[model samples]
Each structure stands twice: as structure tokens, then as C-alpha cells.
Target chain A: MMDSLAAVLYLILFPGFVFLLVFGLFCEWVDRKVYARLQNRVGPPLFQPFADLIKLLGKEDIIPKNVDSILFQYTPLIAFAAVMTPIIFIPIWSATALFPLQGDLIIALYLLSIPALALFVIGWSSVSLYPLLGGFRAATMLFGYEVPFILACLSCGIIAGSWRISDITAYLEMYPASMLIVIPGFVIALLALEAKLERTPFDIPQAETEIVGGVLTEYSGKKLAVMRLMDDIRMVVGSSLIAAVFLGGFIVSYGSISWAGTDLTNVINFLLYIAKSLMIVFLLAVIRTLFARIRIDQMLDFSWKYLAMGGIFQLFIAVMYIGILHG
Target chain B: MDLLKWARMKSPWICHFNTGGCNACDIEVVAVLTPRFDVERFGVLLKGSPRHADVLVVTGPVTQQSEARLKRVYEQMAEPKFVLAVGVCTCSGGVFHGCYNARGGVDTVIPVDVYIGGCPPRPSEIIDGVVHVLNKIAGGGLAEKSSVNEGQAVQ
Candidate 1:
């Protein structure tokens, strides 16, 4: 009974909803701060994302008469729920996930894609000209990024000889030297993840200047808050997933010194996870800061021509490395 | 309530709309977003859509053609929205006053909360206007007046 109770608390609190929300906002703050500093401007405070969300929640939610009311109302909630599930599969404070499965890697990847799909759905349902265009653009951009992202992730799984994320991390821990083989895949994954995030350079789907808010043009108040939070949470999930699959997961040692009824190793591993994820966020911010928004065709061409090829190259390298290792 | 108020004050994403005038005021408004007078520190993002905006920054005089569009834009913004009429043109038509196409200030079409009086207000002045709105938001009095936005246009 106590075990079940602890599990419930674990799922709802730590390494779960609350943690994801706070950490996601923190990552957003770091991204904004870095982006602002790069432009030689003062950035927002740590509480900016939270404040924006809260403020948005307090404002009026206007559902346009022209919109497909049902889909428009439910899309943000659907996207938020979709983005939330993937983080649970990620190994956070430990080397293993809370509920490790044989093919959780693929499951998590597919779950992440749902948010983008949700965006497309909402855009179409908005029935406005900009949103229709935005929806089409989002669907088009997904094809450009998703293939390379999936291939890059699969290459890491290939090296580990397992489809499980924890197993891949375990493999990396076992052969720390083999980290070199995954570097190309990791870079490709990072770039593809950036595209998936719909940030600058790949933000053609919601290019503010060109198409207003694009997919998010008609969203306002509580729904808009939820969507913004969804994006922020998606960033956290994507970065942590990358950190786990590529950066040897969290380095948790067996020495469990219980301090104040909590394992010291858990705390150490949590901080390590945070640090690694923040590093990814920082890199993303730099990319966001340096690049201008690229045209949709350019993004598509670049992703297929360069990122996909790079992912294929990484897959080849991983296969060769594994063959040498067993021989 | 305090937290809600604080959030509302801190994060005021503005959407800029030009009713009709020369593009000088628009240029100055854009300058406020640049590094020289960054308003982002206060969580002010210059949004593109009125739907995503908490504050509407109106530039230029209300021209005959833009009056309907201006009203539509203002109505599109979610509630708890504030409008800052930037430049003398937006405040009271400036040099464009009595022109056949110009219909006077933004308030002639839609209710305006704050008025920045300059032919083309400097970025510093624009930032000052935003700060004034933020301060009013802090007091919790301005939001209540949004619905009754008549003869309440504070200069």
C-alpha cells in the first residue's frame, strides 16, 4: 500500500508534472536570457514565462465564430497532454526510467510528434487563411525534420543493440569511449529537434512577421497560455531526451548516503541531468540567436539534403562500430 | 488576486497598429524593441497578432480607411487589454489634423488608455508610456476602466 502511495507521489510530484512545469519554464528563461544577452539587451526575469502564463490565464478566452469550435477548444489541451507523456519515459534522476520498456524510445519519439500534429490540426480548424497556410507549412516542415530526427535517435539505439532508451544509456555508460560514434547523430538530432521546436530559423510555420502568429494566430487567453506552456515543456522533454540518449544519461553511483531521508546520489544525478539539459538549451539559444528565420523551402531542402544525409552517415558509423566491438 | 495583478503588470505583449500617417512613428515604435531601448526586460514582446496581445500600441492618426480596421483590431484583443496611442498623430492627429482622409486621434475610433505626445515619440518616450501603463496596472485601477473607455483617455 505504502509502495503504491509513494509511486503516486513520485508520478504526480517529483520527476513528474510539477517538476516538468517548473523545469520547462526554467529552460525557457535560460533560452530567453541567452538570446537577449546575445543581442546585447536585458532579458526577462526568471519568472517571466510563469507571469506570462498567469497573465494569459486571467485574460478573456475568445473563440472566434468562424472557427471549428470543438477542435479549436480541445487542440491546445490535446497538445499539452501529448507533450507531457514523453518526459515520463526519460531517465531523469536515475540511469533508468520510472517504467522502463523495451521500445519506449520509439514510443517517446512518436509521442513527441503528436504536438506538431496537434498544431496542424488546430491550424486547420481555425479556418482562417493564415492558419490554413500555417497548418500546411507545419505538416510540410514535419516531413523535413521528423525523418532525420527519428533516424538519428535510431542510430543511437542501433549502437546499443536495443530499442530501449535506458539500455542505450547503459550501453553508453558501459563503453564511454563509444560516445564519439554518436556525435554526428547527436548534432543532427539537435538541429532536427530545433526544427521540431519551431524556433527561429525553422520557425516558418509560425513566422510572426510574415503570417502573424501562423498556427497560433487566433489562439488567445487560457488556450494560448496552455499552448505556450506546451511548447516550453516540449523543449524540456526534447532536451532531456537528447541528454539521456546522447550524454550517457545521468551518472548515478551506487553509494546512497541518506541525508534528510533522501539519497545524495539522487540529488547529484538530478543536478547533473539539469546541467546537461541546460547545456542543450544554451546551445539551442545560441542557434536561435544567430540564425534568421529561413524560408520553408530552404528548411525542407536543408533538412533532407544535409540533416538526413548526416543521420544516414551516423547510422552507418554506428553499425560499423558495433560490428568492430563484437568482433 | 495580487499574483494575477502582478502577472498582468509584468507581461504586457504589445501589438502595434498604424491607423494612417507617415511611417515615422512606426520606425520609432520598432526602435523600442531594438537593443538600445529593450522593453523585453519587463516581459513586453511586440506580438504580430492582436489575439496574442495584452497591449495595443496604436500609431498615426485615425484615417478614414483605417478607422474600421482599427476598431476591429482593438475588439480582437482579449479582455484586460490596454491601448497606448503613440505620437501626436495618434493622440490628436498632429500635423494630419483636419486632413480630408485623417479622422483625428486613435480615441476618435477606439478608446485609448495612454497618450505619448510627440510628432514621432523617441524610443525612450515610448518606453516611458509603457512604464506608465505598467504602473497603472500595478495599482489595479486601470483594468476596470477598459469596458468604460469613454472620456477616460488619460493624457
Candidate 2:
């Protein structure tokens, strides 16, 4: 059991968790910088994420006597680890992943959802009724966002003619339009991610006004730190997947800083991937900074009526592409 | 480090109360959570309980019924708390002061730490006032600045 646990730990945390931390830090750096620029204010240093993790780790963890101690203690850890599982399988350079399993993407997506569900549970199990209300709101938000999200992803999968991500990537080269065919669908998908990942505008459930830090009111110390870290990584992994699926990995390469012909576009493609993901992640953050939360009813209306309309248009465009290909 | 520390010192946990003003100020206050002015980045959090809060932000003039609830919430808060009398109503009951129920601004009942002096001060300005109030709290100077009507102060 120990060895099996160790093996699972190696696959989940060793490379996966470490990579997520580094990527999260980088994405946060870009996000803060862009947000500052957007508002014409100087932002924090690029190493701010590193500083925050250190600071939060050092702060005393405050526990509310009123809280359900068991759920309160474990939820953040579950969330921290759960979101990292998806990153291990996302290809940064090629179709190769360290732990490429059958239906890994599907598992990753579902497991990726667990952390948030745990958050909802944490809120429910807590003593305060306010957090319970926030938890209900979070569950409501999950329902509203997932409809558009599932539609967007399914449309892309249908267009690519594969559910397996690696197979989908393999088919990319066979078509001239390639990842661009999924671009419109990817946009709506990114917005759903913005909500699911609990970024701004869609952050009503956790709105400080209604729920008083929403789900995190009772959390403190290393637990809160871990949860914060988890949030950062979700942004990274979600954006990275969007980039990998729609932005084409490894678009360019260079020769040790000296001029040379590029046979391997993988390095450049990696650069493109990073750049694209960073841009999307920062844009999402900007949207959060710029807008206020809409009423949940309004958001629901958007999901079913407006955002879904956009997703259908994207699906229409994608099917049109496939039709053109075979026709 | 000291200057930065001083800057940090000026930041306080603000608790807002809406007495009887038009909810415009209350709405603007809540709007801070929107991405535009993330008060969390400044370490100025919106704590849930009065016990945890250091700054008491009161918007609207004190109305007869709400004035009592306001005082109760205010009394429940631990000491070293600064009150922000926001809007014209909170300042002097504004346009509503003549009404028999209007008790002028929060100052009419509680000694306001800072008067934010706008019908609805911009969110950034409210942030500024709250930050200034934090300095006052950190200095440990919130004494018996109670109003003349502490006994008859609404409640």
C-alpha cells in the first residue's frame, strides 16, 4: 500500500505539482502586470506569487470554533491536490504526456471538478449559515456554467473527430485549418473556465458582501495558502489546455541564441503556447477587474440564451469546416 | 520598511452600515469586490463580524428605526473602531434631515472618525477614507467619542 501510494504520489505531485507551481507563478506575474497596466497603476513584482505563498504559510491559521473541524481541515488540501492531477496529462511540447492514460482528459476534467465540489462541501459543513448559502450559490453557478462549457468542448471534439486528446492533436496536421477551426468554440469555452475556475464577474457565490469571504471565511494558515495555490494552478492548467487545443503547441525554435535553420518548430511552438495561454489568462483576470458580478439570474440567462447562442454559432462554424473538408 | 509599514498601518478592516441613505453608496461600497478595485489586494478585507472589524463605515443619515439597529451593531464591535459618516445624510441628514425620523448623519448619534463628504463618495475615495481610518485605529486613539445622545441614540 505504501509503495502504491508512493507511485500515485509520484505521478500526481512530483512532476505535476511542481510544474503547476512554476507555471502558476509565471501566469500570476503576467496577470498582475497586465491588470496594473490596464488600470494605469504599477503592479507587484513578478515574484509576488512566491512572496504570497511564503507570507500565507507564515501566517497563523485561525480556526473558527463554530466550524466543522473535519471538513474545514481537509477541504483545502483536497482542492490543492485535486486540481494538479489534470496538469500532468496536458502536453506542453508534443503529443507525449508523462502519464498518458486512456480517458485521462475526461478523468482530469472530472477530477478537476472535485476540488470545487469539496469547496462547496466545506462551506456546507461549516457552522455558519452564510457559508452554506454561498455553497448553494456555488453549486448553482456550477450548473449554469457547465452547460455552455460542455457544449463548447463537445463541438470541438466533434469537429476534430476524436475524443482522445492525442488523437485529436494527431488529426490537426491532416487538416489545413487545424486548431483555428476550434478557435470560436475555444472562446466560449474559456469564458466557462473563467466562471468554473472562480475568477471575477462570475465570483458571485464567493462574493465578500453576501457570504463574508464566501467559502474561505473559516480557512486560515497553510490550509488557505494551499487553496490559494490551487486556485492559481487551475488558472494555469485551464488556460494551458485551451492553448494546447486551439493555439498549436511548439510553433517556433532557435539555436542556442545563435542563428540557425529551424527544423524543430516545437520550441517556438512551445513559446506560442505559453504566449497564447498567458494572454488568455491575463485577459480573463482583466475582465474580472473591470466588471461587477451580474445577478445569478442574469448569468443564467447569458449561459442559456446569449453564451449558448455564441457556442452554437461556433459549433455551426466548426461543422461547416468539417463539411467543407469532406465535401 | 518603516514607510511601507506606515502605509500598511493605515489599512484597516472596514465594516459598512447603511442607515437610511439611498442605497447608491451601499451599492458602490459593494462594487469594490468587482475586479475594478480589489480591496483584498490591499489587505483591507470585509470581515463578517463586528468583533473582527476595526473600521465602522456608516452610509446614509441615521433613520429612526435603523438608528437603533446601527447602535446595537456598533456597540457589539470591539473598541478602537472608527466610524465613517458617509453621504450628505450621514453628514447632516442631507435632504432628509428635516424628516422627524431623520437623525442627521452617523455623527448625530456616534462620533464619526472621518466624514467622507459625498452624496456617494467614489469607491476609490471610500477606500481612501477607510485607509486613513486604519491609521487612526492603529494609533489606538478611538476613545469615548460618543455622541451626546448615546443613551437616546436611536435605540
Candidate 3:
């Protein structure tokens, strides 16, 4: 009972809602700052994301009369909860997570899709023209990206010989040098993740110029704030997943600086995990800054033709490396 | 001030609405968002949805057809909304002041807090106008001032 209670507290407080929220907002700050710098503009202050959230929360909540009241009100919260669940399964500062289970990687992948699904529902339930169109676009984009993303993740699982994320990290730690061979698959997966996050070059679903905020056109106040936070949390999840799968999750010390205490090493590992996640976010921001939004058809075509092919090719190479070369 | 109020003042997302004037003021407003002026330094983002915006930046003179649209957009915005009427046209219809279809300024449709006067105000002036709206928000005068013109639409 005590252990269960502790787990619940941990889920709600430390590595779950509060921690992910703060970390996600920080990552958002880094993203915006880097984007601004790249464009030769001064960005908002470090507290900008936090301020935006607070302001949104303080605004009056408006529910359009024509909308389905129940779904419209609850979808953002559900989406947020869905995104927060995976953080508990991801090993941030240790080899094992708060709730590590065999074959959790598949579950994590499934959980990541819920937010996009929720977005589609939000768009459809709003009973508005722009949002309905946005919803259809979002669903189409989801299909376009999910295949390549799954294939890329499948490659990582094949290389590590385990469907569990902790096992994958353990395998990587056992043979640290194998990361070089995994880089190609990781790059393919990273690009897919960028599309999944709906950044520039693949932001057709939320194309502001074309659809007036797209699926988020009708959302306001607390709901909008929740949705924005969900996006940031998705960023955290994507970058952390990349860090764990490619960058050797939380194994910061390779005998360079030997700390006398395990506690100190743990602290260092935690900080290193944060740094690795931030680095991935910085890379994503650079991609966002350099590229313009692509047309919906163009995005779909690129995802289906180029990314899918690249993912398969990388997966084949990983299979060869792990099956024959490494063996 | 309270943290919520401080946050509201710090991050004011503006939604630009072109009621119906020449494209000059709209261009100037967009310029303010570019690297040169960068209104984002003050956490002022050009939001695509009025639902997510704190300040409604209305450019162009209010046309007969857009008067209802302007009112609807203002109504669509969540509470504590401020309107910044950019350019003389948006302030009082400028060159199109007495034209057949002109409906005067944005003030004719929705209450405006700040008026930026120019044929097309420079990006600097637009930024200044936004800062002034921030000042109004910080002073706690937004509510009382907006209430004065509540439900009073121009004929």
C-alpha cells in the first residue's frame, strides 16, 4: 500500500506532471530563444512560456454555442493526461523508469498518438468549418507520419533486441560503441518525430496562414493553455525518447570523472539527461527556423516517399549490423 | 500586482484584423513582427485566433460589410481584451472617411483602447501603441475604460 501510494505521488509530482510541465516549458523557452536568435531577433524572456500559460488560464473561458460541450471541454485535458503518462515510463535519470514494463515502448508509441487523435476530435467536435477542415488535415498528416515513425522506432528495438525501453538503454550501455551504427536509424526517427510534433515544414494541420490556427482555431482560455502545454510536453517526450534510444539514456559517465558517491553520480546523470534532451530540442528548433511550412500535399508526399523509404533502409542496415556484423 | 495580472500584462498576444482599408497599415503591422522591430521581445505574439489573443490590433477603416465581422471578432475574444486601432483609417476612416461603404474607424464597431495615427503608422509607432495597451493593462484601467463603451455600437 505504502509503495503504491508513493508511486502515485511520484507520478503526480516528481517525474510526472509537475516535473514534465516545468521541463517542457523550459524546453519551449530554449526553442523560442534559439528560433529568435537564428532569425536575428531578440526572443521573449525565459519566463515567457510560463507567463503565456498564466495569462491564458486567467482569460475567460468561452464555449461556442454550436459545439459539443462535453468533448470540447474535456479533450484538451485528456490529451494532456495522455502525453503525461509516457513521461513516467521514460527513464530520465536512471536505467529504469518509475513504471518500467516489458514491451512498454509499444505502449509509449501508442500513447504519443493519443494527443493527435484528441486534436482531431477537438477539431471535429467544434462544429466549425475551419476546424473540420483542420481535423481532416490532421488525420491525413497522422497517417503520413506514423508509419515512418513506427518503422524507425522498430529499427531501434531490433538493434537492441528488446521491445522494452529500459532494456534498450541497458543494451546500449553494455556496448557503448554500437551507438555509431545506430545513428542512421536515430536520424530517420528524429525527422519523423519532428513531423509528429508538427513543426515547420510539416505544420499543415495547424497552418495559420491557410486555416487560421487550424484545429486550435476555436480553443481559448484554459483549454488553449492546456493544449499549448500538451504541445510542449510532446516536445519533451520526443526529445527524451531520442536521448534514451540514441544517446545512451542517463549513462553520462564513461569513467572520465569518477565520483566517490552513487548519489553524486545519480545527480550528474540526471543533469546529463537534461542536457541531452535540450540538445535535441536545439536541433529541432534550428530545423524549425531554417525551413518554411510545406504544402499539405507536399508534406504527405515527402513523408510517404522519402521518410518511409529512408526509415526502411535504415531499419535494414540496423538489422544487418545487429544480426550479422555485431554478432 | 497579482501574478496572474502580471502575466497578462507580460504576454499579450495580438490578433490582427483588417476591417477594410488599403494594405499599408497591414504591412506596417506585419513589419513590427519582423526581425527589425520584433514585438516578441515584449511577449507580444501575432496570434491567428482571436480566441487566444489578449489584444485585437484592427487595421484598415471599418467597412459596412466588416462592421459586423469586427464586432463578432471582438465578441469572440476572451475577456480582458483590448483593441488597438492602427493607422488614421482605423482610427477615423482616413481617406475613406466619408466614402459610401466606409463605417468610420474600429471604434464604430468595438471599443478601442489605443489609436495609432498615420496614413500607415511606422512599425515603431505600432510597437509603441502595443506598449501603451500594456500600460493600460498594468494600470488596472482596462476594465473600467472598456465598460464605459459597453454595448454602445455606432449607428
Candidate 4:
């Protein structure tokens, strides 16, 4: 009974729904602040995203006529669930996650893709011309990013010789020098993750100037709020996923310090996760600030020509490095 | 104040619309979003979609061509929305006051919550108008919807 209670707490509290929610908003604040500073402007306060969410919650929910009411009402919830489920597998404050299943890396990546699919459904079901166009663009862009992102991530698992994220992290921790071998994979993963998150340069599906918010043009009030939250949490998940695979996920081990019956190492590990994840967020913000939005054709061409080739090359390097280390 | 009201005041996603006046006010409106002015510090984002907007920042004189479009955009906004009329053109139609194509002001079509009047209001003046609306929202002063077609006809 006690074990079950603790399990439920872990799933609902720390490193779970509440924590990810707050952390996701915090990461967004950091992104906005950094993006603002890059442009020599002051950004919104730390509480800005929180305030926006609250305001959105209180606003009227508008569903357009001639749309599938059921799908329109539920797509945001579906995306939110898909984004949140991966948090269980992410090693947050420890080397192992709350639920560590074998081959969980693939599962997490697959789950992450659901939000994009949900977005496509949102655009298509809206039945409006712009949303339909946005939906097609979203699906097109997903094809551009998903292959390279998955390959880049799998290359790290290949190097660590484990399909589980925690094991790959532990392998990197055990052999810190092996970090050098994953640099190409790290760079590839970072860029592909940026595309997956739909930041600038890859934000064609929802480019405000071109498509008036693209897939989100019709969403308003609470539904839009949920969609925004999903995006924010996806940012947190994407960045941390990259951080874990390439940057040695949550370097602190369990029980490193047991002081007066209190294990503070978990706290330390949580802090480390914050630092690494924020670092990834910072890089993402810089990329977002530096690049202009590219056309869809250009995005696809870049993804196919450069990003995919980079992922393949990185995978080859990881394989060759592992062979050298063992053989 | 409650959290919802506080959030509404803090983040006002604005959508800009140009009626049929000269482009000077529009230039100043765009300038307010630039690095020098940077209204984003107050969490005022210039959103493209009316559905995503909490504030409609209307500029230029309301011409016959744009009055209907303006009303449509205003109606599309989610509830608890505010309209901010900037420039003399939006407030009184300015030089286009008696012109055939001009409809006098934004208030002739949809209700306006705030009006910042200048030949072409400075960016600072535009910012002030936004802050005025934010203060009104925080103070629980709901925007008054004026009756449409109240502007005097051009003779």
C-alpha cells in the first residue's frame, strides 16, 4: 500500500504533472527572455506565461461552425496527454525514471510525435481554408524533421548499447570520455529537436506572418491555452530528451549523500537537470533568434539534404566509435 | 484582484487593423513593437489572429471599404476584448473627415475602448494607450460598446 502511494505521488507530483507544468512555463519564460535579449529588448516578466495561461482559461471558448465539434474539442487534450506521458520515462532527478521500461526511448519518441499529428487533425477538422493549408504544411514539415530526429537520437542509443534512456545515460556517465564521440550526434539531435519543437526556421506550419498562426489560427480561449501549454511542455521534453541522450542525463547518482537520514542527492540531481535543460533551452532560443522563417520547400530540402545526411553520418561515427571501444 | 483578471491585464495579445487613412499611424504602430519601444516588456504580443487577440489596435480612418472588415475582426475576438483606436484618423477621421470613402472613425462601426489622438500618434502615445486599457481592465472597468453608425455623414 505504501509503495503504491509513493508511486502515485511520483507520477502526480515531483518530476510529474505539477513539476513538468511549472518547469515547462519556466523554460518558456527563459526562452522569451533570451530571445528578447538577443534583439536588445526587454522581455516579459517570469510570471508572464503563467498569467497568459490563467487569462486564456478564463476567456470564452469559440468553436467555429461547420467543424467536427468532437474532434475540435478533444484534439488539444489528446496532444496534452501525449506530451505529458513521456515525462514518466524521462530521467529527471535520478539516473532511472519513475517507470523504466526496456526500449522506452523509442516509445517516448513515438509519443512525442503524436502532438504534431493532433495538430494536423486540428487543422484538417477546422474545415477552414487556412487551417486545411496549415494541416497539410504541418504534416509535410513533420516528415522533414521526424526521420533525422529519430535517427540522431537512436545513434546515441546505438553507442550506449541500450534502448533504454537511463542505461545510455549511465553508459555515458561511466565512460565520460565517450562523450566526445557523440558530438556530431549531439549537434544533429539539437537541430532536429529544434525542428521537432517547431521553433523558428522550421516554424512554417504556424508562421504568424504567412499563415496567421497556421494550425492554431482557429483555436481560441481555453483550447488555445491547452495547445500553448502542450507546446511549452513539448519544449521542456524535447530539450531534456536531447540533454539526456547527448549530455549524460542527470549525472547525479542515487544516495551519493545521505545526511541525517535525508538524501539530498535527489535535490542535487533535480538542480542538475534544470541546469542542463535550461542550457539546451538557451541554445534553442539563440537559434530561434538568429534564423528567419524558411519556406516549406526550403525546410524540406534542408532537412532531406543536410540534416538527414548529418544524422546518418553521426550514426556511422557512433557505430565506429563503439566498435573501437569494444574491439 | 483575482488571478484571471490579473492574467488578462498582464498579457494582452493585440491584433492591428488598418482602415483607409495614410500609413503614418501604421508606421508608428509597428514601431511600438520594435526593439527601441518593445511593448513586449508588458506582455503585449502582436498576434496575427483575431481569435488569439485580447485587444484590437485599430489605426487609420475607417473607410467604407474597411468598416465591415473591422466589425468582422472585432466580432471574431474572444470575449472580454478591448478596442484601442490610435491616431486622429481613427478617433475623428482627421483630414479624411469629409472624404467620400472615409467613414469618420472606428467607433462608427464597432465600439472603441480607448482612443489615442495625434496627427499620427507617437509610439510612446500608443504605448500609453495600451497601458490605459490595461489599467482599465485591472480596475474592473469593462469596455463600453458604443452604438454603430453614430458618425455624422459626409455632406
In terms of TM-score, the best-performing candidate is 4
Question: Which digits, one per residue and each the tens of the lDDT, describe model 3 over residues A190-269?
Answer: 77888889899788888888889899899999999999999999999988887888877448434434456434655767
True contacts kept of each: 0.95, 0.03, 0.89, 0.94
Which CAPRI tier for candidate 1?
high
Query: What does DockQ give for each predicted structure?
Result: 0.86, 0.10, 0.88, 0.90
Superposed model 3: Cα runs more than 4 Å off: A249-262, A325-327, B143-155
What TM-score, computed on C-alpha atoms, does each candidate reach? 0.96, 0.68, 0.95, 0.97
Put the candidates in DockQ order, highest first: 4, 3, 1, 2
Residue-by-residue lDDT tens digits, candidate 4, A254-279 = 34976898878878878888899999
Interface RMSD of 1: 0.7
User: What's model 4's TM-score?
Assistant: 0.97
User: After superposition, which runs of candidate 2 have C-alpha atoms over 4 Å from their true positions?
Assistant: A1-15, A173-176, A249-267, A316-320, B1-155
Q: What docking grade does candidate 3 earn?
A: high
In model 3, what is the error at residue B67, expressed in angstroms?
Answer: 1.1
Q: How accurate is candidate 2 locally (lDDT)?
A: 0.69
Second chain alone, TM-score for each candidate: 0.90, 0.81, 0.91, 0.93
> Candidate 4 overall Cα lDDT vs. reference?
0.88
Error of 1 at A279 (Å): 0.4
- lDDT score at residue A319, model 1, on the 0-100 scale: 89
| Candidate 1 structure, TM-score to reference | 0.96
